[model samples]
Target: FLIDCFVFFQTFFSSQKKMSTTSTGSRLYESSKAVDEYIQMHYAPQDQLFPYDDQYAPSAGFQFVARTATLCVESFDKFGEIREGETLSALDVGCAVGGSSFELAKKFATVDGFDFSEAFVKTAKKMQLEKKLTYSSLQFGETFEDRVVSLPESLNTEGINFFWGDACSLSANENVSKKGYDVVHASNLLCRLPKPKQFLKDCGEWVVKPGGLLVLVSPYSWLEDYTAKEDWVMGLEGPFEALKAELSEKFELVDRKPFPFLIREHARKFQYGVSDATVWKKKCT
Candidate 1:
């Protein structure tokens, strides 16, 4: 029964990211099978935290699982932490697979996460409830290798809840509140939205509370498949300038830095890149 469940989860998760981009409901990473496979192989827990076994050696996947969160955490450290006595509340938008959300839960009293992909959201919910995940990775053309990932028991996960919703349409989500979160985070998600500008505009207006932290990180990998050329904030011209133009009215830029991460496709194959991150604090109105 467990094996059947794993097989079904694998197929469902894999197929979710394999659909056409023209669909209004399709998301960027959620519409790419390769990304789904990559997140499953890496972000899902392993038997051990660090220094994985031989088969999983070169566990560069940790960059996505922990390191991405580390970047956000470090940004907070350099900028600020939650208020001295107040409870922390955060929203992790575009929280693919929930790694960043889990990390945020370590600091916040409660962290709510949302993703456009139902498959990813379901897996994240299971990880929170069952504390374990079982899946297989593609070995070669027809070969597959099974693996099980266990969530760390020490992590305080009672405060994490994940849902399926559009980051671009957060105002419409009944579960999310406008200007309610102490920290609003979106890592590597800017370029993925169909209307990146609209997301930025909406975020500035209603998503983040006044005097809260708003962290935005992205590699600026704008693709026509995911976002239209006219809607891009980062085109051949550049990224940061236009991004500032969008958020400066409501958010003051505090820090701009580079966050490097790695994703492993197999033992021998990997992709490494640095994401441009900007830390913004919503102005007190």
Candidate 2:
């Protein structure tokens, strides 16, 4: 059944690609915004920073996040041997509105979420507060209050934290260093930057501790021009190669998979697509 579903989705996505032109800069931005809005409306309901639905449905973004998070958690579990009472820390780079960060928080003892957008950080904080109040299982103790400043006073705690930070630059590393997360997660973030390989290398340096875990997912092949063909790299394979070349000295590839996904609520008729993901473990001396 799963194999059949994968095949059907591959065929559908291929057909959609043939019908559509490669989106350029503004067009790409617009398309991304549309997809983001659609996801926000359908999947994110805690805050309204993004103009979309807030219901918890199976949107494309949600599916992608779910698959990527599963890979990340599985890799971390296998490599780190995480157990209850262990002070496991996690960092979600480019966390957007905190959906993936919240997912991370559920798995680890401490979560530090960061995004370049102030609005995104604010929305993430609001959602974190709401999650604290509504969900008894999510226990964000004092760490949440000390790290996340924008959160409402009513639900301040310590288990989860949010901050404004950029992926391209590791200025956030200073903050991450303080928490010392055992796992670092980057979802579809590296490809969006101007220097994707460098971004990955920086993530390796800042987020993951020795013997920690690094999980990354990206649909775009390279970090060059979004619309132009100049010096462009192909999708997951190219980025994965570059990541390996850059991080091999300090990390070892542990697991890899392709996440089949589709842009839910798209007006266009595309059946399915996929994103490539990799899990690496920091070398332990």
* Top TM-score prediction, candidate number: 1
Q: What does candidate 1's lDDT look like per residue over 12-123, in tens digits? A: 5465644422233333344344334634544655433233566855444345546656655666666655667778788888776676788888877789988776656777
Model 2 RMSD in angstroms? 12.4
RMSD of each: 6.1, 12.4
lDDT of 2 by residue, 1-285 (tens): 000000113344433432212233212221223223323322433222122455643354434554566676778878874545668788887776666665666677678877655545665576766542221111122111111213234533457788876565665456665534688888766655545555566656655777888887767544234324442334456656756777798788888777665442222222455677778888865
TM-score of each model, paired residue for residue: 0.80, 0.65
Give the C-alpha lDDT of model 1: 0.67
Worst 10 residues of 2 by lDDT: 1-10
